[model samples]
Target: MFSICLIGVIPLGTIVYILFLFFDNPSYQTAIHIFARKKCEQRANKNAPYIASYLSCFLYEVIKKNDIVDIPVSDTSINYSGYAIRKNSVIYRFITPVADMPDVDEYNLQKILQNTVIGQLNHYGITGLSSVYQDTTTIVPSVYIDRILYSEEKHLVAVDVLYICTSKDLLYYQNAVRESNNKNKAERTVYDDEV
Candidate 1:
């Protein structure tokens, strides 16, 4: 089973604290590595703040063993992040992050990112992404006069989150168990498995 401790935040600190049960730390070293490997240093540096999100799409182990290419056209050149895609599906003996799997689709992510999501699922055959600090957390259908529009809303975008965890990352615990029993039964199971 994957330990939540592996759920790291920003990969900046020299000291590592492992929260075996659950961790909300953020780390994009893996993404950064991929960025450098693909010679995307310029883009990565230009968008340093969103590096974690731009490159956050891929899991570390997946890109390490397989070939990854930065399909820049695959991303929205606007306000969010997108990363490289794995050449082939490489399964490891060790436990991988649940969020890395394409099956755990999110609800309120950005439309641009959502387009990338479908692309990742179809082309890359993998899916593990997180909202950058700028992405939306909730979609407000309508707000009262006192309330603000989704675009005008003041969401607390994390500046130095360590890239630890996204809003729905905790669902990993349930998503993991659900993926195990279903054997690809994820959403296709019941109307929706309670996981």
Candidate 2:
């Protein structure tokens, strides 16, 4: 009897979840969208490291133009946001570059930026599905994707990268370094041994 009940339960649960998205409230819809996208977010987190090295240089060119030069270091915690697109009835996944989640304990600049892309992709949907890369975009090299997935493909759409606001002992260290550089840049007149 229990086995017979289980078969109907799975489809019933899926129907209820889908109906929730049919709500009139926009915020409620978005919340369910996010909840559904959790696994995709985790997968994006896994691939952040592999993509970081390739993405860093390109990102910096745009990043510096909008703000005073901000150099990304090795590892940093960041976020993602974007839209999910669909073409026809098929949706392709932007799965992780690995079979398992990678440890992202180390914080760095590139990783943070990469994460923003990943997060953007995940936050936007359960899986990234777009025709952007297929639509006459220039082919770029991604050796990691080729090696792992056995093919090179991308569905990239540009998304903004944001840095996390941080407050810690590190702020003091960075501030000190900035002040020293500013002093060096100023025209210095030597005087006042005691005064």
Candidate 3:
């Protein structure tokens, strides 16, 4: 009777958990994507200053690995510092700072950041993006805004960022997953042998 309950309950619980994740993950992912796109669109239309944070959240939700870092704009200009997608042409690099660059150009920067967001969405299989292209007159929505605040003690400027993708990045991620599985298998083998 004990064995029967253990066997029946364990598998049932595992199946339920798997099913929960399978059903819930897509909805959560879609919600984040929609939120990111909508927030970016609103930022573009209203010149809002929340794109970086929103994009960071979106990247974190989709990637499930990398932690998107917000680069201090004052440190660099012209360097791609938004959602580091790839680095070393192999491993993912979310953001790298650009230094001592020209003065921030809000309009052009907004266009570049918007394209970066759209490009990332496309990479993740969200295709045929229309929000950025809805109004031809606007070209692309702004994903970054220039906002400066001074408190007589410190000054701050919010700069836009860029995202890039390469085949090597994808390969690296696949390899990493394979390696992780191999490691887990090795550990399980050791445990079974000890038992």
Candidate 4:
């Protein structure tokens, strides 16, 4: 009798788990990803900054692993940041502060930036990437927002970079900067309409 009950419960549990994985709150996924990465990194390395960088890298890997975006090769002829695809119809041109730094010998910086971008994109539910192009010659120490566009529309949406010094702090900074910019844009639109 006990064995029969256990078998029945197992199937029910499996179904529930699958449902949660598919239909659970989307924000929960981000929180879970961030928390798990933070805990793992904290355990492996006590250095806060390094842990943060690692978290960024881990997040980038997650995005790539999940097939969220494609990384494009650099073209010397084009004098701008890198390009990426979204929704199979949108292309994004992005530039980062470290894109043009000769001093940036660290191989992991690119990965960190990729993850930061992925996290932001996922938060916005933007998917289907064509390619990612990168440029490292920007003036900002942590800027990424040169331009983004829907290929069909050919219009720029926002200009800002999601800056993250520590993995634990990435979400906070992203939200703050993004929200501020959005608010400013709204005000600008209102002012323009008045004019």
Deviation of model 3 at 137, angstroms:
37
lDDT of 3 by residue, 53-90 (tens): 44444433332322232323332222223332233221
The CA lDDT at 171 in model 3 is: 43
- Clash count per candidate: 16, 9, 5, 16
Residue 30 of candidate 4: its Cα lDDT?
Answer: 83
Q: Is candidate 2 or candidate 3 better by TM-score?
A: 3
User: What residue runs in model 4 are displaced by over 4 Å at the alpha carbon?
Assistant: 1-38, 41-45, 49-176, 188-193
In model 3, the runs with Cα more than 4 Å from the true position are 1-55, 59-87, 90-164, 189-195
Sequence-dependent TM-score of model 2: 0.21
Angstrom error of the Cα, residue 193, model 1: value is 26
lDDT assessment of candidate 4: 0.39
Q: Candidate 3 has which clashing residue pairs, if any?
A: 76-98, 83-94, 84-93, 84-94, 84-95
Question: How accurate locally is residue 75 in candidate 4, as Cα lDDT from 0 to 100?
Answer: 32
Q: Where does candidate 2 clash, by residue pair? A: 73-109, 74-108, 75-107, 75-108, 76-107, 76-108, 80-119, 80-120, 81-120
- Give the whole-model CA lDDT for all candidates, comma-separated: 0.29, 0.34, 0.39, 0.39
TM-scores, each model vs. reference: 0.18, 0.21, 0.23, 0.20
Cα lDDT tens digits, model 4, 59-174, are 33433444423332233221223222221111223322222333222223343444565555445422232122223431212323323332223322122223333333334444
True-vs-predicted CA distance for residue 168, candidate 2, Å: 37
Report the error of model 2 at residue 133, Å: 9.6
